[model samples]
Target: MATHLTRRGSIYYLRRRIPLHLTEQYNGKREITRSLGTKSRPEAERLARAISVELDREWQAASEAAAMTAEGKGKPKIDPRYYDLAGAYELAELEEQHAAEVDELHADADRLEKLLAIVERRREQASAGNASKAATISAEARKPRSGAKGNSVSLESVIELWRRDRQPTAKTVDAVTRAVREAGDPDIHAVSRQVVIAMRDKWIEAGNSVATVNKKIGFIRLLLGIAKSRGMIDSNPAEGAELPPPKRAVELRKPYDPEQAEAVMAATAAMQATDPAMYWLPRLARWTGARLNELHQLRVEDVQERDGHPGLLLTNEGEHADGVAMALKNDGSRRWVPLAGPVLGFAMWAKGRTGPLFPAKANKYGNVSDSFSKRYGKLLRNVVKITDKRVTFHSWRHGFADMCRHAGVSAEVRMALMGHAEGGGAAAAYGAGDGLPPAMLIDGIKRINGDSA
Candidate 1:
């Protein structure tokens, strides 16, 4: 099959000789050799075939360029593919050396003896056909070599330290770890500007939006910055690497048209008795323009008398009545959203509830609002049949904002009513804690609700 698969010790590796013309581009490396990290011949052959196909394309391109240059009597432009592949290989080789150096710096004679014992045990296990146990020990060997006081560390080791140091959310840790690992998992000290650029290009080529790609790159930057701050590396390779600015107009969420809004309300109203989330969430969002999580995380206690009128308090002040910690998007998100119009009766629905108003929707992370967004999306698609991608559950918030703007509500009152940051100097700061007067809030709410109270 021309897969160029070879056995090195007991592991399978792919070893492909560089074409004669491309050897100079590779800095005189005669062949590209990489471990498949597997012993299964079938799996190794599959991987080797894929790698061979990729290399063949680059080699063919280089040969064609050389032919064209010779005919024209000019120098051929170097293909960036050569440098990207070579850079990955260079970093892979450096990671071994970096790990060894860090180990020497930190390992005492006793520590070295213990490590050698572990290695002996692993090799014995491997020879006895207990490959899984050997593999487990192999991973253990990689981890403790992390030199907390030395100048070099592996990417995985730094990621572990970063997680401990940052105490990032599980979601954040998974995302950052995935991004770094996918970017060739370069040594902490070996990640360069070219490595970051190559990673970005790969994501762009895989059809990620510019925003998504940039977010992933931001994770890499933050991760490498952690290594740099601890003196494990001198600089973050991803510091200045980013894609060109996206040229398309930013797609804003579209507010529902009159028919669409009515359709959603009708669907929700039918199921109000059986599914409270379906019924009340849309109404609340439409009237208050509160963010999805803000409404989802509301406690029954939040639905009470505020300034002698019923309202929903969307603040991260304390825990849920059940003790799940509250989280707000920002301080601006902590304010009173008075009940009015369609949502005026929300307090009645929440009357007997003690903890989360939507307890059934609480995710395992104690974020009581996570599942509602997806459920509402299904309702929009399967039940209401509003299939416009931009017309999501958040569209109710957009519709509420549009309603306020169309009703000639002033910007400051609108900002305060919607829990938006009021940016208007010290004057804006005066009564922020007090929120808009209940009367003013009710007035604006009624105006947007199309009922002049």
Candidate 2:
């Protein structure tokens, strides 16, 4: 059974035959085969184990489904619904009508028929015991249940449409797109609970944090919701999928202490000549409590003097001006964070800065924050020698909030300065308070920096 692992040109793959009794559940397929997406044997083994566990659970569910069907009939029964393709013409006609030109309409219809043919042939081959031939045709090419709006549409297409309509963060788009690709890019109609569960297991096995796994799953759930709304799927596959509870509250991230902050600032100060982000971003985070991305994505124009005080204006306006799309977490994230004090060095740092205050480059996903996070993490470990796993770059923001509390800043003032949503209440809805007056913010900043007399 260990031979369930195979290699093709240095890439490991999982190849396991369907259990004889379970072939009925797997559309008469004889095996499950998919790339492990890793060249390392140890990593492949871990992923394979995850896949095996999910498959076992899938087989158990299939057995239960089979049992239910058998009890209702004189003999074992395969669901006739899986084989129904009556909506093929209707779906093809829908696609054809969407095509702008006569030539394109014919071409689109032809393409739809070819996809349908592939589905039909896969079923025929599987039923005839030509398992390998059936496997050669993608198992994803199934005839969707007849008479749905988007029965013939691929999940890929649906995802693209959602992206265009919603405009999620680049990181989100990238993560969801990668997750779907890793899951073999099944069509909307083929995305089942089993499929979602299997992908979740694989992510867990790959050592993604609970939060990371949940966030990616959330994307799939959103996509499926869109599918259901558009008649691509009858229901969301991601519903009711549970995950392990998050880390305990005691183990959650804590704000860095004064000593730790001094150490980080001093260490980063040494790199000012070469890596400006290391020197400036920490100070900005400490002073403003702004999220990391907000500080990292700042432009020279964003730094200005408002009401006789220097501050950074965080906004999603002119996003992608630096080749990476910047996102404000919400409308509240767009605020003017006044400089706490001139001693924090923000005034000097912004004096001559032009495009993109930080020099750190965006990765392939059009993000600079991840790069800075990694560099800062390494500094915490190797340079600053702060070994607390819970204390990282974000701790600065936490520390800022804590300082605000100590400074006797009101909840509204603190939340406004930090760009957090004011909780629901009459106070939160007070008129024209979205942009706090500079005099009040400056006073709060002075109190936070312990400069207020």
Model 2, range 218-239, lDDT digits (tens) per residue? 7778788898887656788787
**Residue pair clashes in candidate 1:** none
Per-residue lDDT of model 1, residues 1-453, tens digit only: 244665544345777777656789899998888776543355557778898889889999998877887879766567989788777765655565456435544744766588569756754654433444333333432443223345545576677776555445445666776665545455565566655676777677657888789888988888788877867666776886767666774555789999999998888787777988878888888888888878877877788676677888777665553335566654556777677766777888789777777765346444566777878888899988988888997887788878889997778778877776667432343224376677777677777767764
- Identify the runs in model 2 with alpha carbons over 4 angstroms from their true place: 1-150, 205-209, 231-234, 246-252, 269-275, 319-332, 342-344, 352-356, 369-371, 421-434, 451-453
Q: What is the TM-score of each candidate against the true structure?
A: 0.57, 0.59
The lDDT for every candidate, in the order shown, is: 0.69, 0.70
Model 2, residue 153: displacement in angstroms? 3.1
Best by TM-score: 2
